[model samples]
Target chain A: MSKNLVGNHIRKLRFNHNEMTQQQLADKVGVTRQTIVALEKGNYSPSLELAFRIAHAFHLPLEEVFFYGDDPTQ
Target chain B: MTYQEKKSIVSLISAILIFGFYCLYMYPQYPGGGLESPEAFRFWGSFVLILTVVSIVAHIVISIIFNIVFRMTTREKEPNFADELDKLIDLKAFRNSFFVFVVGFLLAMGSLIIYQPLHVMFMILIISGFISDVTGSATKLYHYRRGV
Candidate 1:
């Protein structure tokens, strides 16, 4: 299987946003705090909808929040 | 832990308790020696009683503990995909259990053809199937939570 690297800086974004917590981001994005933690740790890749929500939560464009990161799709 | 993880733990504990009770107590001590005993009603009553008590107690304790610890936050509502994944895991786990049941049933039938006492086989098949499903689902939930 191709190990397409998917990465995000959700933690950094949260920090930039007044040290926003995973719970806060999850509340804003309508996802679980655990999901935010997973995304920040690169342990989970969000769906398109979730991606958009996260980007919106951070007040950033989708590309700015989530990067494919040498993904095979790219 | 996620809701899925908590649910998995509860299920696994319940299964273990049921399997243990069946294998250790009911399987050997019950009337009719698992199948052919003339006191089938008595055996069934005991089995049902034990199962109900254990399940109820375990469920209550698990619910209480889950609520106190991980279920504290109302912000993390269960997601749709997470619920779907749980159901999918449950179905897959049940399929695994069914496979065990089928194998046990076949074995029992073979023994019957040889005039062997196959009474215990019926109980064994069903209980084994349940055990298989419970363990499989618990493992899957653990791996999923671990992000494997």
Candidate 2:
């Protein structure tokens, strides 16, 4: 079975959005700061609703926030 | 650390301490040289009852102290809800611990086939349950530290 990888531009987005802290972003998306830290570190994959909420927090489209593919760093 | 992580650490430590005490003190008191004993029922029944009460009170006090210390040190509010990641970690931990419990249970039953002692089986069952809980909490803390 092939593994599915989900990646995000959370760190970049946070920087672009006036250098928002992980806690701030987490607060915006109604999640714990540890979740945001995990997302930024690529240690976790967010749910679809959470993905959308995170994107909405930064006023970005879903694709701009997260991607699913082999190359997580891209 | 998250509240769940902190709670897991507390549980793991307390489980180890309690069970270790049980093994060192209570386990040796059985009439038989080994774990099997007919008279063990009364001792185990009261032992378990007292342990349960102590564990509950200890956990409550520890949690309260931990929360107060964490708030004072970090100056941060506790997250009111278990988020998706927290739930996911919990599910994974529980799944792993369930296997440990089932396997331990089967082994305990297998022991009964050989010894045929009901009280021994009951004691093993209780120990297995405690092992499952400790394993679950340890796994949750591991995931929190190492990533899920």
Candidate 3:
């Protein structure tokens, strides 16, 4: 399938937050590690609720956490 | 691979194996009566019923075994609950699977309209059921690997 348009800085943000692991972030956001992995890999666009939760996990605004573009996540 | 991916693969393989072995075991039991005979009808009825029960039991046993192996190899416990992603993928899988079965049901009815033997219709229905099961598993695997 084509890559998802929605992208996020979850991997980088997780690291910035004391090098948090995928499982830890998933726990904080109430999702499975696979969902976190999918979001970081740009394979999925989380629902608004899940997106907000992830943003809250990083203490960042939604725009700062997620962006919609062809730009790849670093 | 992640646990979800691995689980999807195991499900696909197990579905194939279970259906294959069950068909093999049942093939020799086809009734000797004429295609439209009462015995033939009874055979098909029991066949479908037994197959459903067997598939359910086998899948549960295989899932338990797979969990044991996964834990031993990866040292990670299986997630006990389905999350949003899992639910989404499952819904898509079910949609595809149901679509396939509906098509098969139509074909089976068409066979009767065409004056094909009753046994032919039965076979079509049974094969369609098997294909739908496989389709569901394959769809889950595809979405898990390639994205929603």
- Candidate 2 per-residue lDDT, tens place, B69-136, comes to 77898798777788899999899889989988998899889888897677767767778878888888
Candidate 1 per-residue lDDT, tens place, B122-146, comes to: 5555565565657576665655565
Evaluate every candidate with DockQ and list the scores. 0.26, 0.48, 0.80
Tens-digit per-residue lDDT, A1-74, candidate 2: 12237888889889988999998988888999989877877778788999999989989899888888755554
In model 3 chain B, the worst 10-residue window by lDDT is B30-39
Predicted candidate 3 versus true structure: per-residue lDDT over A1-74, tens digit per residue:
89888888888899899999999999898888888888888888899999999989898999888898854444
True contacts kept of each: 0.18, 0.50, 0.68
Cα deviation of B39, candidate 3, in Å? 1.0
Q: Report how far off residue A3 is in candidate 1 (Å).
A: 6.6
Model 2: DockQ vs. true structure: 0.48
Top-lDDT candidate index: 3
TM-score order of candidates, best first?
A: 3, 2, 1
Query: Comparing candidate 2 with candidate 3, which one achieves the higher TM-score?
Result: 3
Question: What's the fnat for candidate 2, on a 0 to 1 scale?
Answer: 0.50
- Give the Cα error of residue B45 in candidate 1, in Å: 8.6
Q: List candidate 1 stretches off by more than 4 Å.
A: A1-4, A71-74, B1-7, B22-29, B32-38, B41-57, B69-116
Tell me how far the alpha carbon of residue B139 in candidate 3 is from the true structure, in angstroms, after superposition: 0.6
